[model samples]
Target: MSNQHQLRASVLASYGATALEIEELLAYNQNIFDRSFSTLPTKFPLPPEPHVAAWEEYATLAQEIGVFQALSSKLVQLQFPILEGISQTQVYRFATRKGVSADDMVEATGLILQQPEQLQLILHQSFVGVIPVLLASNREDFVSLVQALTMRNEPKPVPDSMGAYMVTGFNNWDRVRQYRQQWSAKNFGNCSESSWLEEFGRLILQKHLYQDRLIILSDGFYSNVSASDIGLSEVEWRRISLTIRLEHECTHYFTQRLFGSMRNNLLDELIADYRGIVAAIGHYRADWFLRFLGLESFPDYREGGRLQNYRGQPPLSENAFKILQALVKSAAENLERFDAQYGQELRTLNSQPIMLIALTYLTLEELACSEAHSYIQKILDQLRTSLKEAEEHLKSKP
Candidate 1:
């Protein structure tokens, strides 16, 4: 098998195998899907096939039963479904990256941890990685986010019922063409940049009516390129994911009203990153992992009011590599702590171990930023406090 195949399987295995019954059901259904999807000629313009009926059978079966529901739940955990568990008040604050104050973040944090394990069980059932598969298939979230960028935010009152229509335009080869057009002058081909840009453009263009919107989501990684090349880093990726989710829901919230879009890319990005971290910590205590990894801090405010790393290095600098290694080590140490405390409960919960997965990314990112030790600590302090409150709230409920 290819390296990519192995990696994907490794990720699945890490979450612990799905229930035997769920594996059987999905396997059979998958066979049916493969047989149906395969018979179609491997050519463009995937002809108008009436496979919706078959698809509906698969979809309905998953939803009405435990396996699919569990799979969906687990996907949210692994991907850190940035938009799923945030509170409504936080929706805008988090989206704008200012919806929640420090106090609010603290309270929200407790609630997240306190949520009943039974609820999380829904995420770890039959096909543990169901959400990722769905994300790949629908591409809806990604597509919708790109479409949101076309509109400008107006400065008028957006009615509570105003709804926007955000659609994804291209999903295949056509998508490739549009992406190439957007970054024609640059060289992005080296890092799966071509494909990523293509999909991003299609999503953005879908929102031809608007011009001041943003989207947050993760892109598939092809290589180990550092963040200096692009204007994003490992830590920034998590934040970006949160920002896109906010823009997506905001588009829907302000659907069809005369609301001008918000500008200020720097502020916009900063807010997204900050908000993403806060929300992620609440659900997964991921910020702690970032802290341990030493890759958790953003560039310090430099001369000219811009953010720059103290090291003056390019993306994924040598320091970043060292940080990553340290993070892995630290995480192993912490897992022992976790096992000592909540390990048994974890086994009984029977839910997807989202905590471990989310923590992994956080720790890795933190390690990557180890050079900025002081800055990393500050952010972690804030993140941990917020998470504690969110957890407290969750526990209080039951």
Candidate 2:
């Protein structure tokens, strides 16, 4: 069965969403869906497992249900359905990096276990990574955080409203490490030629786990990375995956907020990753960009940034490649401008939405300048001129 079909079947079977009920609910919209219900039982076999695998099915179900909820919950609030155990408040998970050292362990655990008040204070300060996702959600899942960002005083405590999951639980260090390793066994990939992602690290996505809530997932990884490259020591587990990966996902939040939603857009991916690298390390470096893209290679290292590596030619047309090259060049130059124009504005953008508006246009370049937002056209205009000049230059080549 198709993944979509399987996913539909899985969600319903697992969640007790019997086909009859769905058919009744959706009959007004379309009957085909009602008639094509899978013959699977109403309940899926097996209880949820301790591993993330247990949550996988639920994740799909939640996301799908969340989408439906987003579209119809307001109109049908009283009739809106709920997941089995997901909470109503927003949940943001923070996980240990694959290389999380004992020091980080102590810091996180100390805050959580030893100093509850301080931990609450810090989390409040950090604003948690998941908040942005809600604000940027196209599904309109979260409440406004604009007030939270603007207020300086200790904002009203979220109390038990927010939740977190440390990727590597600290209770049993060895057992946690073993479980993490086993978990990452499925998350294999390369970071250049040398860096091997043996352990998983980084926040993957901001997903819906329950009603009007979010859940962040992470894994730890062991990679042979130079401490000097990202400017860390030999044992900084945060280097392995925590800092860079989390920052990247945060960028996804940023992009989603700026543009509408993050779809299958290559420009969005590159821009997000680029901004993420900058957030983690203070400045944008081309080598870091290349390494993150798995475009660089060295024999001694294990390619670490990639989760899955594609071989052979990239799936891009020549024209598309040219456009991408121009964007990459623009991106390289903009790296220096990151701190000046883009970075600060990214955090707080009242006057200048150009940085993001420009990116939105770049992805939707198929739109005529007339059809596109003026600011987007203005952004793409410069790139178009540059690309045209390069094109003419290539044609004039001897």
Candidate 3:
């Protein structure tokens, strides 16, 4: 076995895997991919019409009432450009006017409650599926909106310098449904809430009916790194930064939707960052990814970079963390080599999804092993065969 395989086995052992069970981990991960393969959608879903309409109307109201103005004022007053400075408690107190029923303030704040848009509400068509995206041009507005939705209008510390947020299974009260309910009450005296009406309302409204998944993105340099930091012009960096950030979050959405897991783990980050870089630049650049993770100067981890975010559940020991770093560096470099060789073939095959699926089949350790390229190629080949068989079956039916 090569040194890379030795490192792989060492990392697995740290996670409580016995030396003999290394292959078991590989088999387990492969089983997950195999199970998910059959159910993966041939075509991703478009954004639901009703959901789009509801958000559009809500965004219009938020704009008309100057909610963005209030939010901007509050953010400035707090001297926090990002939402990380405020707590959810603070946001709730400010928006509710200290629990007083200031009707106008409450109404305006309520409308601004969840993901109030500063720029626009885009129905983004991602590789996995269409997801609603709340694009905020101003960083302050983005921070405030993220705080309102994720922290319940309360002030809370967001530790990392994150550029985008993905909200899943969000139980949001539908403003459109609220407006319709109010209109009905005003036109008719004391309209009783019937069971059928409740069910119908649930169907039409985003509220208790469905799991609302949205991506709240900021127009900021990725990971709060400035344009000059990477030697790119501001205009060019901003454009690429936005693409990378959106695709990064979408990659998480893809895994969560198809693989039943989205984790704050190094493996997940590596996979997402790979997809993001490819989407932005048409190929993966290992050095760019290393800089993003603060691993540009290998063996010397940057203190405040994203690598600190995935320290494991109970956290790894110091020596184990260093080993993990080595694994990440090796895996990233291996992926770059694989991409350089087979990128065009993968693209021509329209097998980006398959590529993602293949990644899920291997462990971070295996990805760092000497035969990583061959392992990925083997999985890709099998997936291609399965895909072709499915297509032929459909053609025969017609």
Candidate 4:
């Protein structure tokens, strides 16, 4: 009977994304959480002995091999992981074990005709270390360290098969429009091919490799960059950095760690994009992100994007997803309230950047888990109550 419920029903109808009933979605969330969060039923398979779990170690391997380098700009000094010789690494070994050939991977990368060694591994260090370890059956530790490394920036043209390009309507209006049209035609008419599966085939491998210490895995990263053989140019790389993307991807790092790596956790995507947009640009603008996703044209685009991301993997219950969309929509629409309460404290914290960063990730974590509508109201109420506490505390600071 509330606006939130109405929005959820409308958004679901728009996408035709199959959502379970309230009870069903609740059960699904429970089942998935237990499956993913709990200890695995079986030990992760490792490479046979004689091939020591770390038959090799590459702490300075990237530096020694010289495939990827780190780049610095005014804002962020970004580092990525790129490996030239896929045939030699555990990545290829594990892909092969999973029945995906190196050739298949190369094809997926859109770097076909290029040797596996020639294609790059564009990942973070966390992925860099554990990938090979898991391939050889060595990912086990009581404590875990997930360190992701961004690779050096290299300008290479992406393949035609990777779906849409990352260029925006703001920059190239006509082409972007055409690209969106083509996408609509495609999503409407055909089945989406798993070039993404091959393009990002490593994720299939990532799904299985979690343990206590030294557990290596990627929570999530769908960088709107080259998924194929084409490399990124300085111009494109600049777009990624200066725009909302760097924050966007960084948000994935935070949320993936918080929620575990999976796509379509709409809350994860929305919160990531929201925090990324707000933290970087200093206000919330759903239009830019919605446009980026090609969902800008949707009549209910903001709510629609949230729905689509939910459909990506459906992290919350059906009603819960709807509630989330409404909650965020209400927050954005009622910015004065948020700003007066939590926003002021956040602004004060942002004066010192590191504190702001920590709070941003933690706030997102709290918001993601507060699914009940009443719980959401309670959080907002607390934010409002914090105002009085701040005023009293400040007056008492003498």
Q: Could you tell me which 10 consecutive residues in candidate 3 have the lowest summed lDDT?
A: 74-83
Candidate 1 C-alpha lDDT tens digits along 15-71: 343344223222211111011111212212122222222223334456565433433
Q: Answer with 1 or 4, whichever has the higher lDDT.
A: 4
How do the residues 158-188 of candidate 2 rate in per-residue lDDT, one tens digit apiece?
2121111112111222234444555556545
Q: What's the true lDDT of residue 310 in model 2?
A: 18
The ten-residue window of minimal lDDT in model 1 covers: 124-133
Give the per-residue lDDT digits (tens) of candidate 4, residues 251-277. Answer: 444333333443444444554565555
**CA-lDDT, candidates in order:** 0.29, 0.33, 0.67, 0.33
Candidate 1: C-alpha RMSD after superposition: 26.4
Q: State candidate 4's TM-score.
A: 0.37
Off by over 4 Å in 1: 1-315, 348-398
* lDDT (Cα) of model 4: 0.33
Displacement of residue 279 (Cα, Å) in model 3 is 1.0
Candidate topping lDDT: 3
Comparing candidate 3 with candidate 4, which one achieves the higher TM-score? Answer: 3
Q: Can you give the lDDT of residue 62 in candidate 2?
A: 41
